[model samples]
Target: MNHHDPLLEQLNQLISEGRNPDTLHIDTASTLDIVTAINTEDHKVAPAVAACLPDIARAVDYIADALQNGGRLIYTGAGTSGRLGILDAVECRPTFSVPDTLVVGVIAGGKTAIEHAVEGAEDDHGQGALDLADIRLSAHDVVVGLSASGRTPYVTGALAYARQTGCKTIGVACSPNTPVLQAADVAICPLVGPEALTGSTRMKSGTAQKLVLNMLSTATMIKQGKTYQNLMVDVNATNHKLKARARRIVMQATDCDEATATDALQQADQQAKLAILLVLTGLDVESARTLLSQQNGYLRHALKAHC
Candidate 1:
């Protein structure tokens, strides 16, 4: 027994690192068989994530509360986890019309790490705290730490610092009984079991994390009134595709013809929510805008006020 092999011992205890008995013969399998095996393993991800829905819902409430109080939602992780955080954060701006700063992503080794692996970056726990500090993380904000193993020093450090600063912390991982789970105020673990290729968490683990993240951000945005009756009313119509989407949303929300939708959108300055309001409430752009402002952009509330 090698007493110095602590990492080996740690890996041994992780179900994610264990070999999949079902795929033991994958190396000798045909192409179709290999894909079938991977597909079978992939099917477990959704149910595993479903098991953590209660915790995910709790995190979403915390996140929405933080944002409502003029706070931000920040995510921190390493490698694939880090990339996922960045991806989600960037998408929020265009999807919900929120400022980019409202959703921040902090990786272990900075921007370059998003494209290439930064050797030893995850091991520097202190750097994680520093990264959050550098961004001026505040007590009202929420920090979500992502780590498949749930023991990445970088994520643990960030969560610890977030707690000290009075920020709400949530940990997302693929394994249980981890340091991150213990550190965070809420822990979301999706135990997808061993990978088809042993220890490659970027497979099932990554998928699980992405699904949870989707729920966290989308649900929080919904709670904050970013959506109007399942439509992304707050969408930023910056590009051609988005502008087309905005028109379609107005038509859908109001059940109006394309010409009416187009006229409403133009009168409302191309704002989908305002266009929908104008069509549904039969109000001029200014009155619709005023009601929307009073309701803090909640279209349903504004509609109710007019009705």
Candidate 2:
């Protein structure tokens, strides 16, 4: 029974592949030239992500089902990987009305490392297990382990621990044949070739991970009824800016004028989906709220039920 992983060998191959994308030679070139080159490289991210869309969608579907059944979406990673996971988790609250506890982010060095790296944190496999254990993981939870190299000790440890605890574990990596994938239930690897900079996974690899993270979180929200007809319906109006956006979203979705949308939004206590439901179905706030509840916040389903 050996824990030796083949991913480490593949990682060495990746390093030796000479696929650096970060060595942008912009000497004496216009600022726009540098920008254009960077943009061109960035453009490659989508296609890489597109190639793995099926896997991503599958992960999204599974995550949604788990979340619908009262599961948590937990992201685990280190360094750039950790930052991307944290960003995805935090954005869900403001973007899709997901509760903080519903989408949780756990970096290797904790929250403090979000801005500054903590020395040797990524090497702590024990810390990964401790983090998952501290969360009291359950079968309903979905753990996403992120690592560009796909062999990050911290990420592997987290996924391994999650699997042992009966949680649905997902591995998102940039390299092919990553051991992190083997340790998880679902694996999504977007092979983005090599970074422009030697051994700098933060280059193209980071972009690839970000794109996948965006898809995973956004698609899952769409499945959970946070979106209606390509419109974000679960946006949290936490501030004036968001409140205005919420009003605009409802107006656009319901095809109502500003005054009517504002009135309906107020009637629904600024709940975007409920407000849209009220406007579209001509139901009062209480009835609209009830229908939304009945449909589990799925506006489209509630509309079908009401209509």
TM-score, per-candidate, Cα-based: 0.98, 0.91
Give candidate 1's root-mean-square deviation (CA, Å): 0.9
lDDT of 2 by residue, 1-307 (tens): 8686775555567632445545446455688886776676667778878888888878888899899899999999999999999999999999998778999999999988999999999989989989989988888999999988887889999998898888888999877777787887788887766554556778778988888898889888888888999988888898999999999999899888999889988888888888999888888788888888989888899989987
lDDT of 2: 0.85
Judged by TM-score, which candidate is best?
Answer: 1
Provide the clash count, candidate 2: 7
Q: What is the C-alpha local distance difference test score of each model?
A: 0.95, 0.85
**Per-residue lDDT for 1-307 in model 1, tens only?**
6356888889889887889999999999999999999999999999999999999999999999999999999999999999999999999999999999999999999999999999999999999999999999999999999999998999999999999999999999988999988999999999999999899999999999999999999999999889999999999999899989999999999899999999998998888999999999999888889999999999999999988
Model 2 regions more than 4 Å off: 1-11, 15-17, 21-36
